[model samples]
Target: MHTVAVLAFDGISPFHLSVPTLVFGRIGAGRNNGDPGGPYEVEVCAEHPGTLRTPAGFDIQVRHGLEIFETADTIVIPSWISGTGISPELHAALHRAHARGARVAGLCLGAWAVAASGLADGRELTTHWSSADALARAYPAVRVRADTLWSDLGDVITSAGVAAALDCCLHLVRHDLGSRAATDLARALVTAPHRSGSQAQYIPVAVPDAADDDPIERAMLWARTHLGDAIDLDGWAAVALMSRRTFTRHFRERTGTSPQQWLLLQRADRARLLLETTADTVDRIATDTGFGTAVSLRHHFHRILGTSPAAHRALFRREDRVG
Candidate 1:
């Protein structure tokens, strides 16, 4: 079984500490593109293996120590409290684990430790938007984007504030197991499903709009079910039974992106899954995803994923691939 070690500290938010535990715990059985990666064993470890007090006026017990890092396949540092520094022992252990390619993630303010540990230098990352400036100033070599929901570099990952942690963790499951597993997990958890990491962290509308409109939901479902069909913003607006201007406004407020960009991302994501799970040629996958041509597919893949379709398939579908 793959072992995941989650770090906990005194004063850690109970909710923050619970996020990883929740996501990985209930991923009962998962598969990687029809191949099982086996079940995960998630354990929480701390500097002191005992009771730790939370700001929520409660205590949580941790039984494992940082020694677990030696055997853990992944190390997750949950959202951290301000003003804490990584201890020398943890610093050395983190470096050692990273040297061996153990996946490391720092959720929300926990990114400070990952950054301070030197893993995030020269990498693009993000944190809670409120602390973005501090993180940027402290780690000038790390590119911090406060607007993004998460930044994932396969092995090293960081997520934005509190709620975005769910998205990042779900993304991890999707990358590790596959789309079906992640979607089912999301359904079981009752969380929003498959919001790409590149999506904006927060919507720009001044006041939140009622986004539960049935027509908009129906239109989005239609678009998702018909990715191969050529459709435009106007067509989507018509499907929603609204004018183009109104649809655009509502869609932006609801999804934090323009209709065209959302559609493009959906297509790219569909193409990516097909690449991982199928033996189809690039041309077939592109047409099946509404890209129309392999050239168009490659262009979007390069812009959105920083890799070509062949590279993505090789990386995702091969035996000795990234975790």
Candidate 2:
């Protein structure tokens, strides 16, 4: 089993701590006939083995210390206490773990600690949207992605705030375990199995004015069902009953992305689902997802997900057998 060590510190949010623990801790619990014996063994560690105060007005007793990092395959920093600096010892420990080829994850404000450890230097990182500006200002060497739900740089991963932490942890599980296992776990947890990290951090959620038909919603619904076909700005504009220019402006305002970008994202999502759940050929899957050709699919798939379709399928296949 891969050993996972979670680093806890004072003033950490209970939710942030729980996200990784719950996701990784429950790895082996099969849901929907999933294979058993999860690959991870998780332990919570601290700078000192003792009670740590939380922002929620409670103390959590941790029995393991940073020494656990030596044996861990993954070290997770759930959240950081604002204004609390990492001691030289802890910083060294983090660097040592990375040097030994252990993966490091910083969820939410925990990005601060990861950044301070210098592992995030010259890498893309993301934190809670509210603190993104501050993180960028504090660590200019790190490319701070404020809009993404998470940023995964193989060894170093960072996530946006609160519920986005769940997305990040689930992503880790998906990366290690497989889509089937991850989907089962997500169903058990009552969450979506795969929310693309590239999605906007904050989306307006007000109910559409019921009396007026929401053109964007209508257009989106139309787009979802017709992803197999070639979709363009003019087609979507016609569906929304607006001119192309008007539709483009409204699309940006409502979705925070251009029409073409949104369509690409949706197509990419469909391609990923097909790649994970089916045995379809890459060419066939590409056509099914409206990419027209395997080369086009590969281009966008790699650009958006940083992995090839074949490699992604191979990971799921490998994990399915292991699980």
Candidate 3:
């Protein structure tokens, strides 16, 4: 079995700590009748393995130390804490692991530690967009793409944020095993299995209106159905039987964005689905999805999804053939 080691450290976020375990721990389990066993053997390791306090107000006992780095096919570094640095021993072990062609992954702020080890030199990567500037400034040689959810630069991979780490891990599973296995794992995890690393992470969940007005729920349903049309704020306000200003205020109180922006986001989401699962041409997709033109679609696609329609289609199409 392929071994994947996660480097856990003090003050590591519980969310990041859980991502790799959930992804790799179930590697060989048969989630469905047709599913194949997992190819991965995952372990959580640290510089000094033992009872380490987690940021979640809990502690975990880890048995393996940096010595596990020698046997790992992939070394995973989840998000790191601010002001935390890897010791020389840990750094040298990581370097040696990389020298043996082990894949190294730096999820979120873990990119900082990977950069410090000189593993990401001259590599194109991403971290949390909030820290992308500092990461770029500190290592000019690393080609940092601030918009990406994650990037795999051959031996080194990096993810943009905590949630994006799931995307990266799913990608690794898809790469090593197959899309079917990854999809099965995703279903078990109750998350999308193969979100592109270039997809946007800024979706705002729908919030219920505090006023508890019945019209607000109807408005949301209408917006979801009518996303394929030009949905103006005044139009939705009319549909809701409310004045535009009241609608605007209520909309934020209900959905956290103006109707216009919400409509744009809905359209962008529609366009993403089309690009992912349909063979529709970009121009036709743009018109069919209310984006009006290919250029308009391209604009929103990049602004919302952080990648072009063509690229999304290509990536998904490639994955479709992965079996």
Using alpha carbons, what is the TM-score of model 1? 0.83
Candidate 2 global CA lDDT score: 0.85
lDDT of 1 by residue, 37-128 (tens): 54688899998889999899889999999999999888999887653568898899999898898999999998889888888888888798
| Candidate 3, poorest ten consecutive residues by summed lDDT | 199-208
TM-score each candidate. 0.83, 0.88, 0.63
lDDT of 1 at 218: 75
- Candidates in order: C-alpha RMSD to true structure: 4.1, 2.7, 6.6
Clashing residue pairs found in predicted model 3: 27-38, 28-38
Task: Please give the lDDT score at residue 208 for candidate 1.
Answer: 27
- Residue-level lDDT of model 2, residues 185-286, one tens digit each, is 899899977777877788775547762589988898899899989887898899999999999988877777788988898898788778777889999999
Candidate 3 lDDT, tens digit per residue, 87-106?
89988999999999999999
